[model samples]
Target: MNVGIVAAGPVHDIPDLKKVNHIDYWIGVDEGANVLYESGIQADLLTGDFDSIEPNRLESIKQNTKAINQFSSIKDETDLELAFLEAIKLKPTTVYIYGATGGRLDHAWVNVQLLTMFAEKHLDAWMVNSQNEMTVKYPGKYELNKDLSYPYISFLPLSEVVNGLTLQGFRYTLEDQDINQGSSLTISNEWSEKKGTYFFNSGILLVIKSRD
Candidate 1:
């Protein structure tokens, strides 16, 4: 199953819902339920503390959604995190997160970190917004295709150091290189060919496909 999660971020940053393909289930986090409601999408589940949603909007969501998991504002987990846990319980094959970026910088950063949780479970997940699609990758070889919408591919180390980084069919190719966490060497590379391949021997990497 493919699960989609919507978090409370800037609504303008969300991609057009009509074009979002293959999402079998949707989970709305806090004010994000209002987003789904406004877009005429029925949320399969709504999970959040809901401090950000207005009373009427929350009531509307509660009426339309299949299930609701309302929580206290004093909970330990963030609303997005809670929604993510609920998503995993469904055993989705892939998870796509929207409204995860482009509002508060702190929230965006934390949402990026949440990708690692999906990775730990060996499930595929992506954090996508208007300009970028981000995912976490472990040591392995992978193929990437050129996307006209998101033309740049960047690899940033999530670990202290990523070892044996190599790239082929890229504008700026690397061979057996080690990149540090803060290194910008892998930023803004384009596909030299229609398809490119990359490999890393160790450490976690944050792969971001983006456009300006």
Candidate 2:
């Protein structure tokens, strides 16, 4: 199953939720459940402490949602992570997270870590916001198509170093190169053909596809 999750960040930071491609399941984290209701989208699971939500609004959400998992406000995990645990339990092939960025820097950073967590599980996970789409990849070759929507691609090593990096069909090319942390060496690359290929021998890569 493919799952879509909406969090409690600024709704304005995301695209139209109604127009998304087929989503098999929907998850709302705390105020995100209310956001889904406001957008007239149904949620399969609603999770969080409900501390940030108004009492009446929380009641309304509890009434309409099919399932709910409320946690203590001072739990070990964040609301978003709790929601992710349930989503992962369902074993979705892919999970698309929205409203998880463009707010608190710390929260956004945690969400990126969540992306990496899913990637390490060998599941397809992506974070989408107004300006960018982000994901983490373990060492492997990937084929990508040119998209005018997100014309720029950047790769940042999540680990200390990435080894034997190679790229084809891009404005910049690399072969058997190693990139360490704190390097802007792979930022803002453009596709040179209809499709391009990328591969690496070791370490995790954070692939960001973005546009102005």
Candidate 3:
């Protein structure tokens, strides 16, 4: 099963929700509930402080969703994080997060960090928008299949350094290399074959597959 979580980020950055409506479960946060409501989509869980959402839309979401987790505006975590917490509880095989990027850089950064946290729990999660998809991988090997929709692949060290990093079947292959966080050593590489393989021994790495 897969769960899709949508937040209250800029609507222009979100991809077509209709394409992901088939997910087994859906989570909406703050004005993201409004997005689902307007799109005629139903969410399994609705969570947020509801500060950014209109009362009518919020009420509609509360009525349509299986449950609503209302939090105060003064809560510790962001509305999106709360919805993510609810989504992870379902233990979906994969979690797709939308409306999480392309607004405030701080919020986007935190949401990207959330992917690393979920990765630590062995959850397959990704933060996606119209033009980009962000994935965090722990210390392990990963296979990325070739996709024309997203041709450029970049790797960024999530920690101070990612050690023993190896890449195969890519335009720029690496063998037992160490990538530092601030280094742009592995960026804008394309798969030379049908698939590319990457493995790292320690530290988390952010794998971004994107295009203009």
lDDT of each: 0.90, 0.88, 0.87
After superposing candidate 3 on the true structure, give the runs of residues whose Cα lies further than 4 Å from its correct spot. none
Error of 3 at 90 (Å): 1.4
**Candidate numbers, best lDDT first, in rank order:** 1, 2, 3
Best by TM-score: 3
Clashes of 3: 0
lDDT of 2: 0.88
Q: Model 1 off-target regions past 4 Å?
A: none
lDDT of 1: 0.90
lDDT of 3 by residue, 1-212 (tens): 89988898899999989876558888888888888887789878888888977677567678888888888999688888777777777778988898999889999998898886688778888888998988999999888889899999999998999999999999999999999989989999999999999999998899999998
CA RMSD of each candidate after superposition: 1.3, 1.4, 1.2
lDDT-wise, the better of 2 and 3 is 2
